[model samples]
Every structure is written in C-alpha cells, then in structure tokens.
Target: MKIAELLRSAALVTAVAMIPATTATFAQVDGRAGPEFAKLFATYQRIKASYVEPVEDEKLIRGAIDGMLAALDPHSAYLDGSDLQRLETMIDGNYSGLGLSVVMEDGAVKVISPFRGSPADEVGIKAGDYITHLDGELIYGGDLDEAVQRMRGIAGTSIRLTIFRPGRDEPFDVSVTRGVIELEPVTFEVQAGNIGVITVNEFSRDVGQDVFRAWQGIQREAAGRVNGLVLDLRSNPGGSLDEAVELSDLFLSDGAIVSQRGRARGESLLYEAESVYRGEIADDIPMIVLIDAGSASASEIVAGALQDHRRAVVMGERSFGKGSVQSLLPLGRDAALKLTTARYYTPSGKSVQEGGIKPDIAVPQLSDPDWEKRRKYQLRESDLRNKLINEAGLKDEELVEDNLADPRFKLTADELKEQGVEDFQLHYALETLRRTTPSAVALRR
Candidate 1:
C-alpha cells in the first residue's frame, strides 16, 4: 500500500517483528555508531533482561534491523535470501516468470501491466485485473513479496492464478507457463496513413539506443521524413536516469534538459545541449507524449523536459510524482543503504513531486461525479467516462476513470489492433501524431 517503501520492504515480509511499528515501544532512530549506537545496544540489552512482558532477542534484533534500514531512506531494504535472488534476476533483465508486473492494491493483488511478449501477456493477463486469490489461498492477507515469489519459477513450470478483471465480478483462473521475459523496449508499426507508431515500454539502459535506431528506421520507411510520430509511455514504470537524459537529448538541439538538486550539493550536475542533431529531422519535429499515473520517475523527466522545451505537447493525466533520486550507501558486507538523495527538476525548473506534472489539456474521466451509482452501469474503463451515457449522477472520486486516456498514448483501438499492440494508450499517441506537423507546433510522444 505504501509504495514508497516497496523497494526495501519486499525482503522482510516474512520476518516476524518483536515490537510492532506502533505502541511507543521504540523510537525510529539512526545513530552513527557513536553514543546513539551505544544507547541502542544498551537498550536492547535491557529489553532482554526486563520489559513487563517476556521478549525475545530475535524481537530486539528485528527492531534494530528495521531502524538501521529506515535511516537509509525507504528504498534500500533487506530482502529475504530467495526474494533477493529473484529480484536480482529481474534487474538482470531476464526472468522465467508469468511476465506480469503486479501491485498490492485495495486488499487484492492487481495486475498493473504485462511485459511485452511475456507468457502472462500471451495468456491474456490485462492491466487492471485484480488477483483476489493465487492458487486456492486468499492473497489479500499474504505478503506481496511472497506473492511475487510464488508467481515466478523455472521455465516450463505451470502456475495457476485466479484473477478478477475489471468489469467482471467472478474471478477466473488461468494456467500459465513461465518463460524468459525479455522486455522489448521498442515496438513499432507503420500505420495505414504512413503514420509511424513507436511505444517505449521503459527507459532501460539500452532504450535510448533502441529508440534512436527505431526513429531512423521509421524515417527510412517513410523515405526522408515520416508523417508523424506517436511515442507511447503509458504504464512505463521508469528505470535508468541516464536513458531519460539520452532520450531527451535526441530531440533537443541545445538547452538545459534537466537538473538535479540535493542536500549540500546543488546543481552538481547540469544537463544541457551539448550539440544539435546533424540529422535531417533535427530542425523540426512534431510529437505528443501520452502519460498516465503508471508513467513515473524517468518517464516524468522526459515528459516534463520535452513539454518545457516546447518540443512536445504532453497529454494524459498527471504523472506518478516520483522525482526524488536514490543513492546507494555501503552498509557493510553484501548490504547497502539505498537512500533518497536528491530531487530532480525539469528544464523549466518544476518539481514532479507532491503534485505530478499536469497535462496541458485536462480531460476528466467520462463518468461524471457520483460514479459509484454508475459503476454498475459501467463496463470498460472507457465506460466510466462514457460521454454518450449521461453519468452526471456519479460521484467525483468514482467517475475519475482517467486511466482510460493516458496523454502519452493517442491511438485508436483499430490502429492498435492493426499494429498488433492492444495497448490503448499507445494507440492514442499514434493517432495524435497523425494530426500535427512539425511546422505547426512542437509535440510529444
């Protein structure tokens, strides 16, 4: 539920706590090996000797571990041995799993999105599907770390998942075989009208290079210049800051694309225009970037920078507002402290925190305020905002099915299906590209 702590908390799901985080029992303090460290050690010893109720050394150890990790920022956390190994595989960019990214939401594990070409996608695991139960046990009370671990295994093994998809009540079971998930960072399609569509799933280490090459390929297919470009970034939980900067540079000729500010060190790094692209498309390009709540971190940087530079028009709802940076600090032996180090700024000097970057144009979800009354009437996420249906009777919170439209994606369903991309967000983006010309206005994708 508290996503900020997800990075580190994933490892300690099964570690029973001696003292609950509440109850005034202990202070969440981090003392640097001086008197404070001595105090913690001293108190820990006292707890073993006396404490009203009986306590165990293991309990004291857990508290000390929690405090130590807590001081190092929220992201850096202790992972159980097996959980740690699983994540390492994900980071290495190859995993034999169901191929879906999930989140613990509303007492249920929901499928946030499926990786391109993963077995989950092949088996039809869609975004917004709620996993009420995995196998036969209720997953609501289970640890998310365990849920993740259970869903992954060696290639060729079958795992049964019971999913509750949005717009459907009865949970359905799907038998999926795991495979090596190689996330293809780029997917392209030449639209019927000569429009070229490109969807960047996430800004991994090689994404920028893949994107640049794809751009060239599109240009070559269109011969000299492409009619328009659709850059779809919906559900792109960000990675690699370097890729964000590199992708921004591809569009910018010369300007301060982004800046990072932190304690003690302000403006330690300034990214600006080193050189203009000598390529033919350098002078002018019209693009539109489609984003949603799932687009975060580095994705927000690219969207914010491009929008500020007048390079692209940003569309969709606000971003995930994760502008803070993390730096890993050593914590003795295979352990490290991943701490929030800095807050990044857009080229225009805006912070993507608290309130995520808002779109230039605002389009409320179709369900008017008081949508709970209308949810029964709603079908698809698009149905919540069904303009044709009079949902003026819906509640404000209930009607905001804004994910139906991510600014980064502008293609229509027809176009997406034709391109073999069922992602609606990316479809919208490709369509947006068709409507604009480079000379008209700088755009985003």
Candidate 2:
C-alpha cells in the first residue's frame, strides 16, 4: 500500500508504516529439518510436560514471541488489547493523561521528553528522569506498560510520581493532575520583527495542511511581510511518515526528499518533493529549523531534507537519530507486530541511523539552568541497545558536539535570564534573522 494509505489506516502508530497484505509477503521457509527448529520444538515440548507448575499455552506462546521481537531492536514490539487501544487513542490526537514520551531503559521507565505544555512538562519533569514509583509504590524493574497505565487516568485525576533525576542528590515526589491532552500538532506565532515561529508538536494527520494554514495565519497577523520563519521541532517524537514527507514537500520545489531501503523489494522506495504539496509556501523567506536530541524519525526527515536543499538552516543539537522505519503487520484481528522494516536515507544518501542530522548552526539551550548536567546525560538513538548502524560506518565519536563558545551566545544561563531571555536557542535564531539580511543568511550555506 502507499505510505499515505497505510498512515490513514493506523494514524496513531508513530514513526511506523502499516504493511498492506500484498506487501506483507515473507520469504519461504525451508522444509528441511533444521537443528534450531528441532531444538525449539524440544524445549516447547519439555516445558509443557515437565514444568513444576502448569503454564498455559497462550503464556508460553506470547513469551516466545516477545522474546524474539525483543532480541531484534528497541522499537519492535507486539501490540494487543490495551496496547492496541492506547496506540489508537494516541493517534486520534486526544487522550487524558500526562503527555510524555517514555521508554524502557534498564528495566526502568525513563522519560525521553515531555510534550511541551503537557502536564509532565508543566510539572517541571525533564527528560532523562527515572520514574521509580507511582503513588508511593515502587515501580522500579516492573512492567513499563503497567506503570504507564497507572499514570493514565480521567481528566482532573491526580497521580503522585517519584522521580530520580540524574545529577540530583536524591529522588523527589511530585503530584500531577491529569488532563485531556488535545495535541495541537501545529501552533504558530508571529515573533518580533515579523518572524513567524511554528512549533510542530507531533506529526499527526493533516500536519502539512496545518503548517500551510499556519503560514497564512502568520501573514495575516504580521504587521507587514514575514521576515523569516523558525520551525521549532524540539522534544518532538515523530509520528506519521507521510506527514513528514508532506511537510518537507511544502518547502522543496524539486529533488528527492528521502528514500527507504529494506530487504523486501516492496519496502524500498523513494519520496520526492512536490509529490504531496506543490511549490514552497514561504519560498523567499529565510527559514530556520530548531531541533534537539528529542527529535526523531519524521523530525529527522524534515530537518535533513530542508538542510540538504539549503531551504532552512538547521539549528540546535543533533536529532535523536532514528532512521529506521517500523511496519505494523497485523497478526490477527486484534494483534499486530511493530517490526523494523527499513532504514531511511536523506536526499544525499545519508542514513540517520545512529548518527542523526547535524545542524548548520549548533546552538544550545543555555537558558536552562541544568544545561551542562543534562547535556552529559542526554539520550539518543545511539544509546539504545541493538540499534541499527549507519551504512556510512559512522562512529559514536564522530557525533559532533557544540563545545566551542560563540561570541553571540557567550552569556551564561543566569545572565540570559537576567536579560529576559527564557529560551536562548530560539532567541539566538530570532536575533540571527533580525540582524542579518536574507542574502547574508543564505551565504552561511
């Protein structure tokens, strides 16, 4: 099926595509006896007959399936029942809970990044914090799904979270009241000097259209012509791949946007500009895209495409580096497999697997007080166990760090705060645009 159709069928599955029945073909299994298969059958038989206590066949089968998927990579998983329902709710773009993207790290639920303006972010729960307890009960080493379920509740309901933040002396407790998370995927504001600032929270359905509408709104709100644009993609965990392509198409009039390659013939394909949207919306305006370690999958797609075409100057830290694509293949009516099916490449044939897109201007969030401490512990796709390696053989050491001091950003966090700069990265981008001419900004490329 087309990527757009796959996304429409299951819109909630983030950074993944759904494999249609025709493309779900698999390699033929050898009929000859294999030692591995024999061993597996023997173990199953032994467990059924000789175990100390009786175990249900369903439990054993599910355990076997989970074990197989877990050994492959981090993002692959089996979804059924509540898991399937949750995925649907998330994609539908409305749910009642603390909006946070979390992952299982060392059997502990670690916060990847809290959605901006969500209950978790409002409570000051930053990324890399380990959630140790829910309602004063120990949750360490427990099932991550269970902990996540406990955190979800009706709107106005409260839950006490015990957090173990790195660089802290001890764990702390905070109570957050749940609210209906209506993800406004695209929000825009006309910044100072008629600069448009558009923030893409997550790549859900109709994001491309939303962004186009945002540009129109900015034009209406601006005093005159929009000078420049800032596309803020910080702390955004990716969603629909089709939406990513559509967003990228909005800025590019020609050239390949991205390509996906997999072992299956049907999975290898190319996405090009102008395929979804026509000519650029803000073609003449100098654009800047803000990204950080939390940016993944679809975010990387847009950043890489814009940077490759010199359509936008990508700023902020490197992205989360999730280049691999997951294909959701249904096992039955109620269950499915989220399997890693392909690795995506940018227009220049660069795979952002373990090494994500590097920004043209590497800017840091100096307004954050714990910037230094947090930078040292920031998580990326390279940190995940069994992650796919970049085809270019990029090493972890090659991951660029913005350690050099810039004269424009010399002020410390406290100094910036004193100067009324709450977000140094965004402030820097705005100042860069306001101070420099469009030709000067283009010269940086």
Best by lDDT: 2
Candidates' TM-scores? 0.71, 0.94
Could you tell me the TM-score of candidate 2?
0.94
Please list the C-alpha lDDT of all candidates, in the order they appear: 0.62, 0.85
- Give one digit per residue, the lDDT tens place, for model 2 in 1-445: 2334333555543466677644326446576747878987899999999999998999999999888898899889988876766676666657889987787788899998887899999999998899998999999889878888888889999999999887777899999999988878899999889999999988878888999999899999995598899999988888888889999999899999999999976889899998987787888888899999988899999999999988889999998999998988876567778899999999999998988989888898989887778788888888888877788887667886758767866788899989999999999899988876857764244
Give the 10-residue window scoring lowest on summed lDDT in candidate 2. Answer: 1-10
**CA RMSD of all predictions:** 9.8, 2.7
lDDT of 2: 0.85
Q: Where in model 1 is the C-alpha error above 4 Å?
A: 1-43, 46-63, 67-87, 103-112, 123-130, 164-172, 266-268, 275-283, 362-424, 442-445
Superposition TM-score, candidate 1 onto the true structure: 0.71
